[model samples]
Target: MSTYLTILGFNSAIPTVKSAPTAQFLEMEERCFLIDCGEGTQVQLRKAKAKFSKINHIFISHLHGDHVFGLPGLISSFRLLGRETPLNVYGPKGIKAMMEAIFKYTETYQGFEVIFHELSSKNSEKIFEDNRVEVYTIPLDHRIYCNGYLFKEKPKERHLNMKEISKYPEIEICDYHNLKRGKDFILKDGYVLKNEVLTTAAEPPVSYAFCSDTRYLESIVPIIKNVDLLYHEATFLHDLKEMAEYTGHTTALEAAKIARKAKAKKLILGHFSNRYADYQVFLNEACEIFPETYLPQQLEPVKI
Candidate 1:
């Protein structure tokens, strides 16, 4: 299964001509998920070549405008596109009411079903799961109730060794699934062949964590530890550390420290404040602490 992340918008509360707001597209095993529907998210999605109709789930981190201002427009666009599939949206408690108010005033009747899952947990909890992936909420420290999302690929079945299986003509193709499931194969003569001889171990599962618009909270380190890719908010440079804390945001250095403590494989900095024109400074500061830090460009896919 292929897994990757596409950054749609990365700016903080303010939107600029060069950048939008906080939105990301997570593609795992061909299923698409929208992390945050910031302003111009639909436009960014198109720019990124992400099919809008393919995204069935949208996860909002908080009730802030920069994070969810684009939702009504996105959902309205989906209706215009003749989307009939039920859309599942997960967010904080007031999301449903907010959407309802927008729809009522705009008289936008959704042709498709919109299901809302309200989140209010203060601890890490599994919120969504399917055969391919499982999503958990990472409780974050923000001025308002906030949560990040953790995407983890499910364990895959063992790979069948063709060469080993070819040695036994008696073993039929129907038994391949059993062998992959680590079950022994019984021959016609009642002889048993162990599964270990026929298959090899599957590759380890991959995980991605998305954290943004929150203060430097060490409590989340254990929840996101050892993720393949960690996208944390770096709203300000080290010099503005005090301002970052006051605004419930994190500086680049603080983001790097969290990544290092969690032992993340790679750290991707985002949610930049508009004060800084050049984002290289954020990368430079973060890389000093966590060498495997990255800064994503708009519409570029980062493979995990």
Candidate 2:
């Protein structure tokens, strides 16, 4: 099993010839999570060959059109395809009410159930928790009621060393499972076997943070520290720094600063302004401070 992240759309508010607004698809084990379904998100997913039917959970940062314009359409399509699995949506307040209005006016109905978990507070609270993962809301500064999301993998039990395990075939395989689970086993021969001697610790869990359309606020640094991967908005270049501040957005340099301060392992920058015909300037600006910075184009899949 693997945890991977894919970028479906990277533009903000507007759709350029080469880019579209904020959408990300994350694959964790057998489940998938969709973040910010902007306009044409389903189309982008089709191009990326991501299985839309596998998406049982969706997280929307805010009510902005660029962040959620495609949600209604995707839900409509799910009905057409006759999906029966229940869907869970996590978003800010008014999301549930907003979708209710749409369905009421349009007379749209789904074959499956849809559950919405509204997030209204500013504190970083646990919004979702399950056996495989946990998610929290990262309060963000934006024009509207906006926030970011953090996806953290749950700790897993250790795997036994198969070669070493084969030496004691006479031992019950059930006992070996106990040993791998950090339980000490007492062999029939009066030998005490420690769990550490037979198994190594599991690999550290990975995490991803998605900060879309937020201003340059360093307050979120502590919360996102040491994340395996971070996707922050870089909607403008240094030349338009003043405009960025006025519009509550960040430049490439500012995004890099947050990554550096947080000590993140890697930074992926996107949500570029419409003025930029080429994204090389944003790339060059961010890489100056954080060497692991990358500029992801539309439909580029970044392994987490």
lDDT of each: 0.93, 0.88
Let me know the TM-score candidate 2 reaches against the reference structure.
0.95
Mark the 10 consecutive residues where model 1 has the least summed lDDT: 175-184
| Model 2: lDDT of residue 283 | 88
Tell me which residue pairs clash in candidate 2: none
Against the true structure, candidate 1 reaches a TM-score of 0.96
Per-residue CA lDDT of candidate 2, range 1-304, in tens?
A: 5788899988888887778778999987556999999998999889989989999999999999989999998998998999999999999899999998998898889889999999889888888888879888889998888889999988777888766667765557777667756887677787876777777897778899999988898988998999999999999987788998899899899999999999999999999988888888998999998889998856767778
Residue-level lDDT of model 1, residues 249-271, one tens digit each, is 99999999999999999999999
Error of 2 at 34 (Å): 0.1
Q: What CA root-mean-square deviation does each model show from the true structure? A: 1.5, 1.6
User: How high is each candidate's TM-score?
Assistant: 0.96, 0.95
Q: Return the number of clashes found in candidate 1.
A: 0
